[model samples]
Target: MAPNQDEETLESLLEASKTPEGRSRLAASGAVATTLRHLSASSPLTLPYLRLLRNLCAGEISSQDSFIDLSGPDTLASILLSSAASVEVLRAGIQVLGNVGLAGEVHRAAVWVRFFPDGFLRLARVREREVCDPLCMVIDTCCSGVGGRQRLEELCGTDSGLRILQEIIETALKAGYREEWLEWLLFKACVEEQRFLSLFLTLSSSEESSTNLDISLTSVFKPELLTTQHAFLLDILSKCLTERPKEVTVSGKFALEILEILKMIYNIVDFTTRVNAAIPTGSPAIDLFGCSLLILRDICAWEDARPTETDKDSLVNLLLDEGLLDFVLSRLEELEPPAIVRKSMVKEDNLFPVELEKRVCPYKGYRRDLISVIGNLLHRRKRVQDKVREKQAIPLLLQQCVVDEENPYLREWGLLAVRNLLEGNEDNQKEVAELELKEPITPPEISGLGLKVEVDEATKRAKLVNISG
Candidate 1:
């Protein structure tokens, strides 16, 4: 038989495999073994044979069995790893493997045993859409089960494997064409598979990360990817938290999943804060901290956004029960005064430097973020408001109502937090009313703006007024 005739035969078989009966017949006819044998016969016949194999195995368990039984995975992995193979051949081979992977756990394990940790990572570096898209499909399928997921963890345990994964994520984020499979692969590997800490460590491996806060995580991971995943999580939690109590109730399993996710976020925030005394001004850790707080704030707001008359396991209540409010308050107490306030209080004549706390929240808007979380927690929850008064947090919050250069919007967030703390709570309002009346400290920025803090003798309340008044 001529080579062209063989190509024509393979193409015919590929077309026939579109039907279920055709696929079953093709699998039963021992044609899979013949194609694997001929993959190395000539470069010209390889693509058509691979395409035929791919079509046969797609969504067909018997055909996939034929491919695996005939040692097709090993043969294809060899071709993909061969130096003589062209990009076109590699892409087609990968598509076949991806199809085989879609069958089930057994099929996926076969593919992972051959291509993973090196073959797949190498192909992933090719950077072409034709190859990367199918590669992503293969990895995503392989990560769908316990065995395959364990194999992925092993692959990522190596330094080279971790680097390759980072490159894949960074490239996918910056690629001209968007691929949903790549996103799914990342979510599977990082979120579902619990590989986020590993991937995060890989991204933070740069030495300058220790000294540079201005460097964005985009230097390693793309912002769009982070934003997309965060939004995805927020949307899911919103739906879960805001469901009407009468229609359907939030389940325990889902609540547990959400609690675990919240714990992870809190750990990231806690870990970053503890490791560094002064987080760099624009460091990735700072963004991570801010993002974590923002997620917590949004979750709290969504949990309280719709109040139910009946007692259910609410996320806000769960957060409070977990002492998230106390945690935030304790963190706030550890932070050094914002840069602007600290500068205003420094005495020019004194030679001694003020000793600062070792654990400092150095990021811009750190105060505002902490305050935002408190504000959301206080929303429609009288217990949180009363807790704030009991904790003596009201005075600390009032102190935030000054113009601080470092924490943008600190004043606004402070006002909002105070409002939420006192709303519908007479005890909190009375606590604020009984506080000693003292003049507010004027930062240089406020003084430059002709704004001065004044105490009204009649009302016995402090207010901002023009210097002329």
Candidate 2:
């Protein structure tokens, strides 16, 4: 075919793939091999052609199968690494692989291996708005399963991956994007290399994290701080702590791990107030708090969603091994109770009830997560139940359940914590029974609207002026 005629023919084939009838015709023409062959040659239509392959593969099982059959993975990789192809072309090629990878494990593995033989994720211009969206989608999709997740570790071997992610995180926060996607990326990196957890913690916190803390948490992780053979925690958190953290291999590390997670959650949410201030609604401080709350929720849900196994330790013991309840309950001292709950009271049906429906500071999602953490721990642990009784947690839980009216969810969580404390342990139940769960009272209810007849009365000022004379 003539050059012009061949170009026209390829364009027609591309157009046909867009519609059902065209897909049928293109299928007969063996579209995958044809596109791959043409892709090998330099032409003006190369990027457009790659984009067409992306569309064709979407939502069509047959195209996905056919593309893989014709060695589409190799073709895409070549375009991605091509010195001759433009960045636009490489990106389109990535989308096609991402789409194909969605079919199943084989295709996903193929795409994953060939997609970034060079660790392009670290190289991609994630700061640019346009380049970021599709690349984020691709990375998220590629991390769809255990196999993909395992392969993603290879992304961390190169130092650039962490450095790039750090830059994006810091930059995005300054620009106020927060970039949840980048946070996830940083999280994945940390999960792979435990040292990066410290970095993730620093980045996840408000910018003031480094300068404002009395200890300046950043200083704790300096390379010089650790001995030459630095030993990180084998059990609890690797990167989530310091770069050169003390090794913790002793029994009952789980509770300690939970404590660390809780501590970080507390610092991030309480960032504004730690220095004697409150974060305003819709401000960046609150945004960081909400974001930190989401991270906490995600942590709980992740553990909750894990598949069950018979050999697992009792939930409460796993939670209580380090006297986890004591540490966490201690942490709650900084979490202030609701202001309105303290000040507000109302009369209803001859009863003065402290407002139960208004939520206060501790009713926020992060605190609910804390409640859930306790509830999850205490669900089946006799030891935790005993500790709750011993530590007198029943009263604390009762206060939350009684005073928090604004958050039904928080109220539910509080009730759950109390229920866990009360379950299966008669002595713990008895301890709770002895505590005073009182009714609210108003001054009117106490004084009963007295209507005393007035006798001769003198004001204080009059008495000072000798008005009696």
Candidate 3:
């Protein structure tokens, strides 16, 4: 056939695959499948043929029959595995398998294993730049599909499969593919998918398997890998701490589990320490209770909908805990200074240096000093609907703004901060009013000589004279 005729046939097949009627015709007739197989196997497969194959596999073709006679599974796999095909062709083939959900078909799966049993493992090791969206789609489909988990488990069980995955992980690490998407996939496989976790735990439990996994993870932590994966690892660790309550036992060993994971993923002790410290403190039982609340809060907040009553109650309880509350208050206070000082310095460096230098200053002065920072935090808290905590946080913050005689300029700021906090709470407003019971000073009157007179004394003297009269 002429190249133009072949192109036209390919386009027609693509169009047919896109609609239900056409798809049914293609799948039922098997003509499309025959054409696809022939075109795919042809030497120097043209781009048009490759596109048609992709469209067919991508489920653009509605017909299941279109897939039936498109070469035997083994033939299709062999064509894909052949060194003659380009990476684009291989990717198109994998995508077709994924989109068609053919991984569930035993015959197709057997062909897949026979021809490219290690294909995913190979793709996993490819350079980050080369690991395109189609590859990710293929991995996601296969790992999440029927028999995919079992296949992964089987592969992990084998020395060769394990070796291949290990190498791929190492390559991914080295090539700087530690973004959230990749980490999320790994997290899903390790935590969400029972088989993967089971296999991982089983392997890590054994001295030999543990050694190999460790070596693989270690190889993945080369400097470039560490740099790329650090934030993602931290994110994963935080999520694990928040979400994987079942995995974390109440015993100190759970903390150890976290530490172990952190050590394996990254070498940042400080980051791990911060996360560990963030874990609520109390008796293991109470700690578990509090952590559970935190976890619930995190999960509810993550979802699109509002949290249920149970979630709200848990968050409230967590927020109201004196120790936890105090910690949050302390953080608010700690965060208040740099903002005040930075702004104050920015506004008038020389005059504000004294207040800024002090390690402990009143919150009132701090606000005056760092209005921008406090405003920003308040904005964030408000955006997140933590108004109650934000209200509670203000007083503790204001106390830090108090100024002494040595730094009198801070007194006005201290008072202002107090006023701002008081304004937010009715009880605080009343308390503030009672604290400043003295009447506000009135302006003095101008005498006939055009000089101001002391109003308080003059009024008092006039009242006394009138009484005497």
- Candidate that scores best on TM-score: 2
Question: Model 1 off-target regions past 4 Å?
Answer: 1-3, 6-12, 84-88, 156-161, 188-195, 206-290, 294-383, 387-469
On residues 114-183, what C-alpha lDDT tens digit does candidate 2 reach at each position?
A: 5553445442533443344455456656666757666565544434343434444433433333233443
lDDT agreement of model 3 with the native? 0.40
Worst-scoring 10-residue span by lDDT in model 1: 274-283
Question: What are the lDDT scores of the predictions, listed in order?
Answer: 0.63, 0.49, 0.40
- Pick out the ten consecutive residues of candidate 2 with the lowest summed lDDT: 459-468
TM agreement with the true structure for every prediction: 0.56, 0.57, 0.48
What are the RMSD figures for all models against the true structure? 10.2, 13.4, 13.9
Error of 1 at 231 (Å): 15
Task: Encode model 3's per-residue lDDT on 1-469: one tens digit a residue.
Answer: 2434655666777777676566556556554455454665555654455555555555543422345344444555666556566666665665555565543455345444553446666555455533434444444455555667776565545555554444444455466543334444445444344223233333333224443432433444333333322333334434654665445322222222322343343232221111122222212222222232333223223222223445333433333332323333343454323333343343443422334323332222222333322322222122222443345553344333433332335435444434334433444444333423433211111111122212122222101011111
lDDT of 1 by residue, 416-468 (tens): 77677766777776555555333334434344447654444555444556878
What TM-score does structure 1 among the candidates reach? 0.56
How do all the candidates rank in terms of lDDT, highest first? 1, 2, 3
